[model samples]
Each structure stands twice: as C-alpha cells, then as structure tokens.
Target: MKKFALIFVVVLSLVLVGCGANSDKASNEKKEEAKTITFQSEDGKIEVPAKPKRVVVLSSYTGDLINLGVNIVGADSWSFDNANFKDALKDAKEVSEEDVEGIIALKPDLIIGSSTMKNKDKLKKVAPVVTFTYNKLNYLDQHIAVGKAVNKEKEATEWANDFEKRAEEAGNEIKAKIGENASVSVAESYDKQMYVFGDNWGRGTEVLYQAMKLKMPDSVKNSALEAGYYAISPEELGNYTGDYLVLSRQSSGDNSFMKTTAYQDIPAVKNNRVLEVESSKFYFNDATTLEYQLKTFEDFFLGK
Candidate 1:
C-alpha cells in the first residue's frame, strides 16, 4: 500500500508538470500569433505587430497614405494644397501641432511623419514613429521608401511605375503638341528677385527638359547650369525668355513682379505663353504630388 501511494503521488506530480508546460506553450503560441509588419524608415528600420489600426501622419506623406487606402486616426491640420484636411483626407481625425495631449488621447498605434517633427521624443512617447525625408524628383525612390515603411512596397512600385509612364507619355504629348525644339523656362519670384529653376533643381524641371525634350532657352541654358540660385533682373528676363514661361505665384498673393514692364515685355508673356502655377505644387516632388505638377504642365503647354 505504501509503494502504491508513492507511485500515485509521482504520477500526479508529472501530470501537473505536463499541464503547466502545455499552458506555457499555449501562451507563447498566442503571443506568436500576433502579426508583425516591418517599416523602412529614414532614422532606421522598425517592425510593428500587424497593420497599424490607429495612425497619425504629420507631413507631406499624408496624401501618399491616403492613396494607399490606410486609415488615419490623427493628422496635422496644415494646408497641404490650400485645401482643408477634410477635403484632402476624408474621415481622418485632425490635430494641431501643439496638441500633444490630444494626439496622446487618440492612442495611436503608429505615427507617420517627416523629418520636420521637432518633438521626436514626445512623439515617440505617444507611439511608434516612422519618419521620412523627401527626395527631390526621384519619385521612384521616394515611393519605394514610403511604401516599404507602410508595408505597401508592391503598391508603391506600381504607383511609381505608372507615374513614370504617365510622365513619359505626358512628355511625349507635350513634345508632339509644342514641337521637340520648344524652349521652356520656369521661374518664381520672392522678395523682388527672380529664381529660375535649373535642370537639377527639382524633378519637374528634369521631366520638362530631359523627358519632355524641351530645350532651355539660350539665355537660361548657362544660368540653369550655374551653381546656387542666381538672381536675374527683370531687364535680364530676356535671358530666361523661352517659347513658354511658367511662373509660380508668390505664397503671400504678391504678383508685383508680373506687373513689371520687363516681365510684360518678355516674348513668352507678350505671346500669352506664360502659365501661372502654384508655388506649393511647383516645389514638392513626391510621386503622388508630382502627378499634379505634370498635369499642370501638360494642360498649360499642350492645352489638354
């Protein structure tokens, strides 16, 4: 009887140990079942569990995320295109820059931002933050970087490919409409100085000259290649004078430069070939925003 009791006690202890092991195993399995997603960021690489259900976008990538069909729980209330966030991003929660408390209140899973976020620590404390830097005119690289960050690499590549194809097609269409030899000049005025875009200034200019096959007017050819943003007098407008001129309106609604006699006398202006573009649109070179810039040029130059 003593031997049988001892054996029974040992058996009970083994069964309890086995049950504890099984329970531990089940808990680990549950933890493993939670999904993870990887994000390629400018600061470094980051991995999060599953698709971020609550996201906050701080800067320019807002449009890119919207295009990818990501649900944004919070966002900065800045004018991306002089349009309200509601207009640009429907159903997304809007937050202000100073509203740290408000952002935290939302309990976001992820925060998509640009390098401009000043409060990195505060933002990270709220949630995982992924930041990006804008690459001028290299829309493909920009798309790939942002896409990988959001687990939409394939979609980003497709969008980039389509963008390039459309840009090339637009270039071809512009070339056919305006002739291959057509000279074009793009410029903006700030504080009484004229800033002409160079070949390497932004992707739009590269597309206009390299892809569209538009020639830089002889006056602007040398200056466009010059280093730094050079100032040109309204009298020297002839130097930038081309078959077509693209001017960007000043942010403060200042059009004083356009009223200058020298500007009015330019061949492009006299012939009404000058197209006015928004300064904001002319400056940003992201894949998503680039389409608008390309379309603006196509519409202006090709009348399409």
Candidate 2:
C-alpha cells in the first residue's frame, strides 16, 4: 500500500507539470497571434504581417506614423530635423543612412522606408520592409496614402482635411495682405546659380498659386514654372524678379558662389524684397517642415 501511494503521488505531480506546460504553450500562441498586424508598405499596395509592437521607420514617414499615434522603435536621423518629429519620438533610436546591419540588429517587425534605402534586400531578409515613393500630389491624397500604410487612413484623411482648411484660411489672409497682383518667386542661391521652385516642387506652391490665387510673373513663366526646379546664372535673376522674392540661404562656407557680380545686380537685391530662408526647411517638403515654411512665408511676406 505504501508503494502504491508513492506511485500515485509521482503520477499526480507529472500530470500537473504537463498541464502547466500546455497552458504556457497556449499563452505563447495567443501572444504571437496578438502581435500580428497587417502593414502596408510605402508602395501603398502590398500588405504583409507585421508585429504591431516593433516598428522601424527609415524615412520621413515617421511623421505619418506619429500622426497615426503609433509608437516607433527606431527612425532615420533625418526625421529629427523637424521639430514635430523630434518632440514626438524623443527617445527613439536613430538609424544612419548606411546602417542596415544595425537596423537588422534591432529585430524590428516592420521596416518603414522610402525608395532611397540602399540595402533593400538585406533589410527585407531581416524583416518586412514597406517603401513609399513620394511625388507631387494633392495633399489630401498624399496624407491618405500615408494613413493607409500606417493603418490610420480615416484619421489621416481628417488631418489632411483640417490642414487644407487651415491652409485655405492662411492663403486667404495672405491674399488679403499681398493683394491679387503681388507676384512671388521662391529661389535659392547655390554654387553660383539660382534655383527656383515652381508648382511641381513639394513646398506650398499648390496653396500659394492654386489655392490662394497668387500671380506668377511672366518672366518666371516658361523657365521657372515649366521645369518645376531650374538653375540659372545669377545674371538671369532678372528673369525671376517679382514683387516678393523668397531666397533660401546657402550653408555657411558656401561663399564660393554668392560673391559673384551677377547676384548683386538682381532686382530683388536692389529692391530689398529678398527674404532669406532656411535651407533645411526649403528643400525638405515633409509635413512638419512644410508648416515651418508656411509660417516663415507668413512672417516674412504677410507680416503676420
């Protein structure tokens, strides 16, 4: 009887251990299932399974993710230049331009990026990567595309709508201040040439020209407006002469070009209508930077 009792006790302990192991297995399966999420790539098409908790952004798409209220594990350093992004992901790790190996080491479940990434194959080998190609589109469409990729399409649309409304209000105020005939030109001096941006450039040209109904001078019509962005001799600045000139300041130590005689004779210089702008905000047309550009324009041109 003593031997039988000992055997029974051993059997009970084994059964309890087996039950606990099964419970643990079930819990792990549930956790794995919970982690799964459908993520759309930058391409705005292909959807793949991504672990909802771990996300790595390799582009300015960090703004979209932030707007979507998603937490990012890592992001490209360039995104930090914008105040909105910097404030949103203060603790996020920075991924360098050539740091695919480092990114893979993070073991992120979803890799969000642009077409500019060099190590696409390597990144994909480590995890699922979604890339988006940015282009000139209606702001609403662009915002919606970003929202869809981040699984926040509805919220993105609403944000875009609100942005458009605010932009329209700002445009109206600018129109009131500048009047209908006030011509505007946006240009940057670089490498002894003047680069002018037009409707195709991703700044606020659409709102300025289309929404606000600002006039484009005839001199900048064919050359400046047609090519979207074109470089001309400093002597050709006469062609860009408008009522308001928005000049983007080249970086320091870039005096190699600006010291030339052609830039001095420009009407914008003589009239003192040239407003020097920050190069970083001028070139990068992301959401946060765009707002900065708009505010700068308002302060410089509208006296707001």
Candidate 3:
C-alpha cells in the first residue's frame, strides 16, 4: 500500500510540472504578441517591433535613421559613400538589396529600402521590409515618414520644425549680407557630365532655395526647377552662373573646367563668390549634411 502511494505522488508531481511549462510558454507567446504593432507603410500595413534594436538601411535614409537614434547594423553602399556618414556608420557593414544572405546574417530587426528594390519579397521573408519612393514626399515629410517607421515620429517632427526655423533665420542673414536680389546657382560635375540643380535636389539646393529662401537665377529655374537637374556642357556652365555659385565638387572629379577661360570668366568665379562644397558631403540633403551646408553657407557670406 505504501509503495503504491509513493508511485502516485511521483506521477502527480510530473503532471504539475508539465502544466507549469505549458503555462509559461503561453505567457511568453502573449508577451511576444504584445511587443509588435502594425505600421501603415507606403503600400500596406505590416507588423514591426515597437522599438527596433537592429536596423538595416537599404536606401538613402541613413542620416534620417541616425538622427532618430536607430541602431543601424547594415546600410547600402551609397550611404557609406556619403562623407558625412563616415564616422556614424563606421561599425555598419555595406549592404544592398542584392545582398540577401549578407543582410540575413546581420540579424536585423527591421529593414528600410526603396520601393523599387529588387529583393523586396526575399527581404520581407527575412525581416519586416519597409520601402519609400524617392521624392514622393518633401524632405521634411520624408524625415517624418522615416521617423514613423522607427517609432519616433515626435522626435522627427520636432527636429524638422527646429531646422526650418534656423534655416530661415540663416537665410535672412545671408540675404542681408549678399543682397536679397542676388541669385545663387548650384552646379556639380561628375565624370563627363556637368549638371545644375533645382531647389529640391541635394547639394544644399534644398537649404538655399527652399529653407533659406535664397534667390535662384531665372535660367536655372527654367531648366532645373521642374526637372530637378539639367545637364549642361562644361562650356555651357557659365550660361547658368548666378551672382553666387555653389560648386558641389568631389576631390577627384574632372574639375578641369575650373581652369578653362569660359569658367573663370563667369562673374561669380571672377569675383570670388564661389563656395565649393564636397560632393560626397553635399550630395545628400539629410539632417547631417544639411547642418554642415547651413554653416558653410553662413560662413561664406556672413564672414570671411
């Protein structure tokens, strides 16, 4: 009779242990379910971590993500190419939409990319993928959209407002020093092509024309404003010159045109009213680059 009681007690203990294990599993699953929330992406709603810890950027929103305090483990080549992003992305690996296996190895909690990225479906299978169409929203709105993706909309919005105010103030100061009617032109040369940009394009055009309310020459406005950028021959560069010229130049680019008589004869060039910005740094209009640009422009006009 005593032996039977001992066996029965052991069986009861095992049953209780099994029930507790099942209960703990269910509780864990419920907590996991509560940790994710649905985000209304550009295409449709998808679940994303409430606080993403490891993010992989497959697009140009690197500066935006950095500004919003996201921990990026991987990013595209273009982001790595941006000079201003060098220190910020020092620990990040160069990843692209084509790097499926590489990205998977990074163990990213979220992935942000462009709408036209080829590996969208494949990436989604590895992690939640969010994409944005370029220029679909203005720069500030784009930042806000990125913030929402990372669950930091309020911080993004606050930065946008503060940046706008500072830019406007700086523009007023610049206009006062350079004359409000003075026109400024932004141009850059890469490979065999020389191009002029409109207000929305990078190279400080957004800060100069949009945020600072600086003046753009009629010729550039007619050509680049609608199309974003217009290619011109090196000889025709002078045709787009304004009272002040912002030359977005790369250290290694074919700036041989600068030594040409046609370029030197331009009023802005002859008068030393040209501000040369590094192409890699100026190529992006994100918060990191924009702040550098704003200071550059201010010092160029307001100081020596």
Compared with the true structure, all predictions reach lDDT values of 0.71, 0.69, 0.90
Preferred candidate (lDDT higher): 2 or 3: 3
lDDT of 1 by residue, 1-304 (tens): 9999999999999999999999999999987666667665666667753566788888766657666666777777552442423554565667755678888988888887777677877878888888876443254666566667667788988987777777788888777877888888877766667777766455267567655667887767777656524568656776776898878665576677677787788888899998887676665455545666777787777777
Clashing pairs in 3: none
Give the least accurate 10-residue stretch of model 2, judged by summed lDDT: 42-51
> What does the lDDT read for residue 82 in candidate 2?
53
Candidate 1 Cα outliers beyond 4 Å, as residue runs: 1-34, 76-78, 84-86, 93-99, 190-193, 199-203, 210-213, 217-238, 250-252
Tens digits of per-residue lDDT for model 3 on 172-223? Answer: 9888888989999999988878999999888899899999999999999999
lDDT by residue for model 2 (35-131), tens: 4455545444455453345678887567667766777878876676555577777867888547987787777777777787778878878777777
TM-score of 3: 0.88
| Least accurate 10 contiguous residues by lDDT in model 1 | 79-88
Candidate 2, residue 84: lDDT = 54
RMSD to the native, candidate 2? 8.8
How much is the lDDT of residue 41 in candidate 2?
A: 50
Best by lDDT: 3
Of the two candidates 2 and 3, the one with more favorable TM-score, higher being better, is: 3
